[model samples]
Every structure is written in C-alpha cells, then in structure tokens.
Target: MTDCIVVGGGLIGMLSARMLHDQGLDVTLLDRQEPGQEASWAGGGILSPLYPWRFPDPVTHLASLTQAAFPSFADELLQETGEDPQWTQNGLLVLDPGQWDVAQAWARRWPDVQLEALDQPAVHGCEPALAEGFDQGVWMPRVAQVRNPRLMRALQHSLVRRGVDIRPRTPVSGFRVRSGRVTGVITEQGELLAERVVVAGGAWTGGLLLSLGAPPIEPVRGQMILFRGPPGLLSRMVLNDDQYIIPRRDGHVLAGSSLERVGFDKSITEAAAQTFREAAARLVPALADLPIEKHWAGLRPGSPQGIPYIGPHPEVEGLFVNAGHYRNGVVMSIGACRLLTDLIMGHAPICDPSPYRIDRADFSVRRSNAN
Candidate 1:
C-alpha cells in the first residue's frame, strides 16, 4: 500500500501532503474539484482571525504557534515555484470600538504580538482613507496577508515540483476500513488502498466522514466583494463590524465578508455585496462609490468554536483528520499541518494535541473496527 492518501486538495490537504512527503513518505492528494479553487481561493487571506481575541484559546493558540513561520513559508513557496504569493506584512487595523478593551487585554496576555491603541486622530493617521468619526481602534503590526489565488497557485505548483502526487477531480466518498484500521479510500475512480489516510475535505469532510458516523463538520458560507482602486487606496487591512478590507499590491482592494450557514451552497448574493460595500466604505468612504469589481462565496469548514479536529480518528487506527478550520484555514494551515504530521508519524506534536482530537466530542463512528 502507498504510504499515505490525503483526501481533499484544499490548503489544509495540500499542506498536509507536502509536510508528510518532506518526511520521505509517499503521499498522494485527491480533491473533488480542482484543488485550491474552493475556500482556499475565495478567502481574503488575512493571516490572523478577525478580532482574534473573540475566539477561544485553542484557536488563538494554533494561530499564534505558527505566526512566526508564515513569512519564510511563503518565501519558500515563491523561490521554489517562481510564483509570487504576494505575502505582504500589511498590519491589521481594527476599528471596532467595542472590542478595543477586550482586544487590548488579550494582546497583553500574548507579548509576542504588538497591539497599539489608537485614538480618533491616530486612527485616521494610521489609515487616512477612513471617513472620520472613529474614536478607538487597535493595530496589530505583525499581521500579514497573502493573495488567495496567487497563494493557491504557488502552493499547487510547489507541491507538484516537490514530487507530491496531486490529483484533482478525484472525489473520495469514504474510507476502506478493516480490523480497526483504515486500509484506503472509496474514491470515485475505484478503491485505492493506502497505509494511512488523512481526510481534510473542508465543508465536504463531514459528508465523507458521516459514512463512518463522525461528528458534524458542516459548512459555513462566507460571501466576499472586491473593488478596483489605485495602489495606495488602502494601506494596512482594516477590520470593522467583523468585515475586513484587504488591499492587493496592484491597486486592487478586496472587501468582505459575511458568514452564512447555507449548507453546500456557494451562491453569491447582492445583499452580501451591498453589506460588504457599506462596511468597506465605513473605513474608506471612496469604497462606497467605487465599483465592486467582483463578488464570490466559499464554504468554510464550520466547527464548534472555530477549532479544527486534527489527529487520528480515534477508532480507526490509520485514519486521520485535519479539517473544520472555519474562517482560519488559510492562516491555521501552518500549525495544523505540522501538528497533524507529528501525530500521524507518532512523534512529539508541535503543540498540545488534546484540544483538536476527533474524540474530544466523545462520539464514536459506530463502525469503530470493521470486518
């Protein structure tokens, strides 16, 4: 049997495959659609969670654990693939007055991150595009963003060049388990056996895991809108009312996003576009009058408390999972992939593995061990 078969080709899956392959293991990545076209491409690519303090410790811990590694990771991809992921260290500015106190308190807890409290004048000074009347804000100087599409392409290319087998349009329906071990997968083409399997299938992960009676790992759709503007139109990503405006180096700015739990649907709505436009304009008045260049939606793997389940499937010996990252999949990929690899290879994990285990819910797949 092959060493490992990774089911799902999103960022999480690809990164998982890449990390394992680097360990001298044979790895194959399979995806339902073209890899990286799903949530990985649709996300705004903010390196940090919006209002990071609002999330629980697990979410913040995973994110913070891998915070310092992102820059070199991106550079490694670009140098090896010759594709620019546009990893920019553009600071994150939060304009929500209500969260300032809590955010500042959270910042103090983590001294590695620098968060500055800005008054009304300082807020405008930081990002002059604002329309005014903003009294309080918090600025995270270390936050960065990557162009999603570019990053996806870079990662895809990097994996191919690194000798990882990435197969798109390969829908995995379920796993082939035997005697308390995952033997392989029930793929669309046919049965493909492997020594181990990692199911990182974002929104669709739950559906595939359901055959084995896994817990709910549903989809949360987030809608996004974009605006074309000059290079300096918006400097430093601005977050307000849970919506963020991210600027690309090439004079294009992206404003997003609304969270919706609408099942497997990826439909874009005008209501969401208007909502994003209004939010973006609140931070930059010109965005209100600027044309919305694009609108799209992607299904994030929604989980309880925005925490992803990483590690073994508990019952199935060789079956592992690293899905359900919700909105933080792109940013969380670093720590989650490393952590998943460590657990899979029976090595010391990069961090505590208790919080992300599938068995944390105390549920079984009914078909714990198979015939």
Candidate 2:
C-alpha cells in the first residue's frame, strides 16, 4: 500500500508528490493523460499574477511566497536535472496608467515588492518594441518568469530520480471510501490502497470531489497564441488592458489569452487567435510580421473569488486537496506544495492555511453519496 496517492499529474500534483516523497512517504502520482500536458504546460509562465492588487489577499500571499522562493527553486532544479528552466527576472511593465494608484497601494502593503512609476520614455526605453503609446506605466522590476515546459520536465526528471511512482496516462475512475475515510483509489487498472489521497486534478478536481459530496470546480478555458520574432526584440513582459505579451529567452513571444467559460473545450477559436494577434501586434508592432508559431488552449481550475482550495476535505477523512488554483497554479505551486505537505505530515504549516481551507463559510461544496 502506498502511503499517499496524488490523483493528478499537473504542477500541483507533481510538486505535492515530490514534497511527500521528500518527507519519506511512499507516493504514487496518477494522471489521466500525460503529466504536465494540461494547464501546467500551457500557461505563459509568469511568476506573478497580472495585477496583484486586484486579487484577494489569499492570492497575493501565496503568489508573494512563491515569487520569493522561485529563484532558489529553479536553481535547485537546474543543479539536480542539468536542465535550465530559464528563471528570468526581466521585470513586468504594466502599460495601463489608470491602475498606477492601486498598484502603488499594493506595493506599499508589501514593501519587499519593488514597483516603479514610469513615464512614456521610460516605458519605451524598457521595451522599445512596444507600439507608440500615450505615456505612463508601472514597472515591477522584481517580477520574474520561468520556462514552464522546461520546469515541468526538470521536476519530472528529479521525481523519477527520487523513485516516485509517476504513473502517466492512468485515469482515476473513483475513490474507495469506507466510513468517511478514503481507503484507496479505484483507477482504470486496479485498486491502489493508500492511507491518504490528494485530489490535484486541476479543472477536473471539482467533478472528482463532487462524487464524494465536495464543491464542484469550474473549468475556465484560456486560449493563447505564440509568435516567433527576432531575438532580443523584447526584453520584458508587457501588460496592457487585460492582455499580456511574454518573451522567452529565444526570439519566441507568447501572446494570450481569452478567458472563456465554455466547459472543457480545448478548441482554439479563430476569434480568440485574432484577438491575441491584434493584442500582440498592438503591444509590439514588430510581432505583426512575425510568424505565428502556435495556438492552443488550456483549462484553468476556477474557484470562488479567485482563491484555490488547498486543505483537507471537510467531511472526508484521509483526503486532501490542492486544486482550484485557476490561472495562478504556476505562481502558487511551491507554496501550495509546502503547505499541503505540512498538513499531510502533521507538521506546523508554513503559512496560516485558514484562507485556503476547503470548508470556508462563504463557499460550500455539496455532499452526495451517489457516484
């Protein structure tokens, strides 16, 4: 019997499994599709949320913790796997001067986060590729990004080296619960008994939890487009309005994304592609001539008020959750993993887990025995 079974293979699940293994637990990670091919692979890899002030306190807290730990985390991964995840601290430029005041307030609240007000010339100097815009912006010099695909690959490699039972393409059918305690998981192959189970199923987490009378998680589809442009054309991430353009170490630029409520549809619509293209071109005119490299969509796990469920199930013993991260899974993965591991191992939590508790009063998951 495995000591723990993590029932999702995305960033959250994989990180959770790694942490559990580090704690000397017998861990097995099961995924329906290949691990990390879901939202974890599709995100733009921004280390910080687009607008920190706009989110709830819980979101900001987790993001801040992860952002601080990212450099060391990426370095450790690179040293272990010999694969560079390219942790770039090129900064983030918010082109909307209208949000300057709110951004300043948030920065003040967290003195550690560096925020600078910039004039038109400064914005242009920071990113000359940007289209001729009317003046002012905000610069967050402390903001960073990672090459998510590489990061995922490094984590998978490290986990494999650590002897984790990383089971890809293994779909979990249901949970084996007896007297309110989860005894094991029922997968397509067979029953795997475990003392504890964590549902890190991303967008599918809600449905899995709903089977055991938990709150349903909604899938928010985001479509993104990639552009191959001249290398060194853009130095930093540019955010204007609600759209963003992220530059990789190479000449590749990622422009995204359209948040659609259409359930589980990974189809890339022409309209979304056009919207992304227009946004990219508007942000950096040179991108207009650049070749369209790729277009795809991913499902983000959506929950109430943009906060995720990260604690144990209210009613189900031996069950835990680390899902509903929505678009911030990459940003929150490390902190979430640490917190979840602490809870499962009965150690003092790294942060107060009250904000991310599954049984918050405002949001309640419906309980049912019917599968």
Candidate 3:
C-alpha cells in the first residue's frame, strides 16, 4: 500500500511527496494537469513578501523561513535534477510617492533589512530606464528571487527520480472516509487506498475538501504579464503600489500583477493588461518598448485571516491540508511542507505550526466556512 497519497501536484504537493519519499514513504502525487503549470508557474518570482510590514506575524514569519531556504534549496535541486532553478539575489526596489507615510513607516519598521532611501538621481544611476523625478524609494538589499517555473520543473523531476509516482491529469473527485478517518481518495480514474492522504490542491482545495465533507477554502485569481527585453534591462526586482516588475538574466521581464476576487476566472483582461503595461512603463519607461511575450492568470488559494491552511484537518483523522498560500506560495512552500511533514510523523515541528494549523479559529471563520 502507498504510505501517503498526496493530492494536488503543485509546488506544495510535490514538495510534500518529496519529503515523504525521503523518509522512505511510498508516495503518489496526483494532479488535474501537469504539475507546476498553475500559479506556481504564473508568478512574479519575488521570493520576499512584497509588503511584509503590512501583513500579520504568521505570514511574515513563515515567509522569512521559506526565503532563507531558497538559496540552499536551489543548489540541491540543481544537483539532483540537473536543472538550474536560477536563484537570483538582485534585491527589490520599492517606489512610492514620497508623500505617503505608509511606505516610509514600513521602511523604518524593517530595520533588520537594508532599507535605504534613494533619490531621483540615485534611482536613475542604478537603472537609467526608471522614470525621472521620483521623490524617494526604498531599496531592500536582502530581497531575492527564484525562477519559479524552473524550480517547479526541478521539483517534479526530482520527485519522480526519487521514486514518487506522479500522475498528471489525474483529478481527485473526493476522499474515502471511514469512521471519521480518511482511507483514500476517489479520483477520476479510480480509487486510491493509503494510510494517509494530504490535500495540497491550491485554489481548488476548498472545493475538494467540501466534496469530502471537509472544511471550505477559496481561490483568488492573480493575473500577470511577461515581456521580453534585452539583457541588463533591470538589475533588481521592483514594486510600486499594486505592480511589480521582475527581470531575468536572459532578457525576459516579468510584469505583474493584479489581485481579483473574480472567482476562479483565470482569464486575462485588456484592462488588466493595459494596467500592467502602464505600471511597468511608469517604473521603467524602456519596458514600454519591449514586446510582451505572454499574458496569463492563475488562481491563488486564500484562507481566512490571510494565513496558510497547513496541518491536519480537525474533523478528520489521517487527512491533512496545506493550501491557502495566496501570493507567497512559492516562498512559503519549503517551511510549510517541513511543518506538515513533522506533524504527519507525529513529531514536534522545530517551528510552531499553530500559526498555520488548519484548525485555527481564524481559518475556521466564515471564509473557511464557505466552500
């Protein structure tokens, strides 16, 4: 029998499968489509919380731990899968109207981070493409990024090589519950019996849970755009207001993103596309001349009180959940998976999992109540 059956083959699910496989568990990863082709691929690749100070402690703490894991994780993925998950430490430049006290307040709050105020000339010297006459900006030297899509690919390849049975195009319909404990899952193809089952279905996690008579979760759609530009166009990732611009070493500029509660609608809009282009142009005028390589959207899983729904399900035994990562899914994957793994093994997690537990009151609110 498979020791663990992990549903949802995205970053979180794949990571959970890998960790379990490492512990010598018989693991099988099932997904509706190819793994890592969802929100994990359609992301800005910003490894840091764009506005950490604005978020609560749980989000900040988990994100920080996951951010610290990227450097070494990237190297491990490359060595194991022969895929270079380009981890870039180019930092982030946050620009806003100098008149806004919120931005300045946040800059001051994060003293541990190198938040330097940059003037118009200083910004221009750093990137000639920036719009002139900006009042002030904050430069976070510790901010970093990873090529998210590449990392997902590496994880999938590595998991399979490590003896994980990955089933792409396998949609899980619901779970097999016996006497309040989950026995296995009922997929579109067939039934899978396992000792334990984990749900990492991303945006669709809540619906999947409801089908199993489990609690609810919701999906928030995040739209993004990608542009192809010449190399050296940008030396760092940048954010201003609701927009962010991420550049690749290979001359591709990822401009994003807009958050919408449009309910699982992963379709791009002309207005959103225009908004992104305008925002990118405002940040770096040269982006206006670059050709857009792609425009797409992905549904991000969001939980109530804005914390990730990670850990065991309260009402069910032998079933677990690790979704609702919203925006920071890529950054929070490792730390979140580590906590979940520890919980599954009946061992105490090094970091407190209470903040991200599925049974938390915040997650059990109306937001988590709704399917």
Predicted structure with the largest TM-score when compared to the true one: 2
Tens digits of per-residue lDDT for model 2, 275-318: 98998888888898888989999999988877888889887899
TM-score for each model: 0.96, 0.97, 0.93
Task: Tell me the spans in candidate 1 whose CA falls farther than 4 Å from its real position.
Answer: 360-371
Better of 1 and 3 by TM-score: 1
lDDT of each: 0.87, 0.89, 0.82
On residues 1-371, what C-alpha lDDT tens digit does candidate 1 reach at each position?
A: 68999999889999899999998889999999899999999999999988899898888888986677889999999899999988899899988877778887898888787889899899899988888798988989899999999988998998899888888888987789899898999877999989999999999887788767565678899999889888888898998888888999988899888889889899999888888887778788887777778899999999888999998886788889999899999778899999999998889989999989786343553335221
Off by over 4 Å in 2: 360-371
Quote the lDDT for 62 in model 3: 76
Measured with C-alpha atoms, the lDDT of residue 41 in candidate 1 is 93
Tens-place lDDT digits, model 3, residues 1-371: 58999999888999999998887789999999989998888777888777666777787777777888889999999999999989989888877665335655765655555667788777666566678766677777788888888989899889978878999999988889999988999987889999999999999887787744444457788888889989998887888886899989898999888878888788889998899999999889889998998999998887665678778888789999988888888878888898889899877884888877655354455354564
State model 3's lDDT: 0.82
Worst ten-residue run, lDDT, model 3?
Answer: 360-369
Which candidate do you rate higher for TM-score, 2 or 3? 2
